[model samples]
Target: MKLDILAIGAHPDDVELSCAGTLIKETTKGKRVGVVDLTQGELGTRGNAETRTEEARQAAEIMGLAMRQNLKFRDGFFQNDEAHQLEIIKLIRKYQPEIVFCNAIHDRHIDHSKGSQLVGDACFLSGLRKIETIDDSKSQEVWRPKHVYHYIQWYDITPDVVVDISGYINQKVEAVKAYKTQFFDPTNKEPKTPISSQNFLDSVTYRARDLGRIIGVDHAEGFTVERYAAVDSIFDLI
Candidate 1:
């Protein structure tokens, strides 16, 4: 199905951690939003692949996503070669989204930056008519999303734009909590990691709040853009 906005992450909970608030806010406005995870996060310290998949499904429902898919690329080892780019290109064409949200340009995890460039390159290549691709044996048309934005993840990159998600913070929190195995959970009996700490869980909300404070809003999500963000009038800046 055609999507208004498509959010792509290197792993399962990456989208929830960074852009869930924006996705929730968009869906509330009657937009068709979808998610594409490049990896299953199989290399995570705590949860296994099967459990992560189930958690992602629950999170999708919580966010009211129109579509949710996992590319199943190797968690930390996926490369940005032709093979990988082609896979991402197929999704870009299939969804034909107007806006695309991808992994942070720079982050603590190596996969984040790699996934950013992979998706960015794929979005561009997907628009080339000669790059032939097919789905279900039928030739697919080329498509390019109008905008590609990178959401902040593990790093505090300066944002090109900040989206006010005041009313959707609760939904974002709930969607993130769906991944009970990945985040802080005292009873999981799983080995603790950097993200498994209560401090990290609190950072998600505090980060949003911090961004919101800078923009005079209750809550907000930050994103870095490929180019200068412009609007038809000065009134567009809030």
Candidate 2:
């Protein structure tokens, strides 16, 4: 099905952690939203790929996503080459979304930046008529998203756009907590990682709260844009 927005990430929980509130806010308005996980996060310290897959599914349901696809690329070693771009281009053409949310432009994790550039490049390439992609044994038409937004992660990059997700922060938090293995859990004996801390989990809520404070909202999510966002009038922003 055609989507209104498609959020792509380097790992299973990335989208939920970064922009679940924004996505859920859109979905509540009857917009079709989806996710494309570039990897299964096989290399994670706490859980294996199988567990992450299940967690992704639960999170997708929590976020009310219309679709969730995993490209299954290597967890930490995926490249930003033509081959990878073509695969992402196929999804871009197939979904034909108007807005595409991708990994942070720059982040502490190497894969985040890599996936961000790869997906951004693919979005542009997918619009080229001669790129030639096929889905389900039929030729696919080229499609390009009008907007590409990079969700903030690990870093506090200022946002070009912030959406009021006042009523959706709890939903976002639930979706994020769906990844039981990755986030804070006192009972999880697998192993402790940088993200498996109480502070990290609390930060998610406090961060959104702080962003909302800047705009006079209860909660919000921020995204960086590839270009200057435009509106017909200044009041249109309000």
Candidate 3:
């Protein structure tokens, strides 16, 4: 099905940690939004691939997403080549979303940045009619989203735009908590990772609050753009 927005991340919880609040807010306004996880996060120290897939589903449900799909790329070794790009291009053409949210352009994890460039390149290639793709034995039409925004993750990158998500912050927290194995959990006996710390959990909330403070809001999500952001009217900027 066609979606208004498609949020893509390198791992399952990336979308939740970064842009789920914005997704929730948009979906609440009757927009059709979906998620595409590039990998199952199998490399994570805490959760296995099977567990992460289930957690991703629960998180998507918490955000009231229309759909969520996984590319099942290698957790840490996925490359940004023609083979991978074609796969992502197929989905972009299939969904034909107007806007696409992807991983941060640069982050602590190499995969995040790699996936970001991969999706960004796919977005452009998907628009080229010569780049043929097929689905279910039929030729697919070329489609490219008008805007591709990278969400902040891991490191602090100044955002070109901040989306006020004050009303949906609680929902974002809930959606993030759905990944019980990945984030802070007193009961989890697995080895602790950077994300498993309580501080990381708090950072997610406070980071939003901090971003919100910059624009005079209770909570907000930040994003970086590839090019100059355009609005139909100045009133749209806030």
Against the unseen true structure, what C-alpha lDDT does each candidate score? 0.95, 0.95, 0.95
Q: Write the per-residue lDDT of candidate 2 for residues 56-120, one digit (tens) a residue.
A: 99999999999999999999999999999999999999999999999999999999999999999
Candidate 2 residue spans exceeding 4 A from truth? none
Error of 1 at 161 (Å): 0.4
- Name the TM-score of candidate 2: 0.99
In angstroms, give how far residue 186 of model 1 lies from its true place.
Answer: 1.5
TM-scores for candidates 1 onward, in order: 0.98, 0.99, 0.98
Candidate 1 vs candidate 3, lDDT winner: 3
Considering lDDT, where higher is better, how would the candidates rank from best to worst?
3, 2, 1
Identify the runs in model 3 with alpha carbons over 4 angstroms from their true place: none
Task: Give a tens-digit lDDT track for model 1, residues 81-109.
Answer: 99999999999898899999999999999
- Sequence-dependent TM-score of model 3: 0.98
- lDDT of residue 159 for candidate 1: 96
Tens-place lDDT digits, model 3, residues 131-167: 9999989899999999999999999999998999998
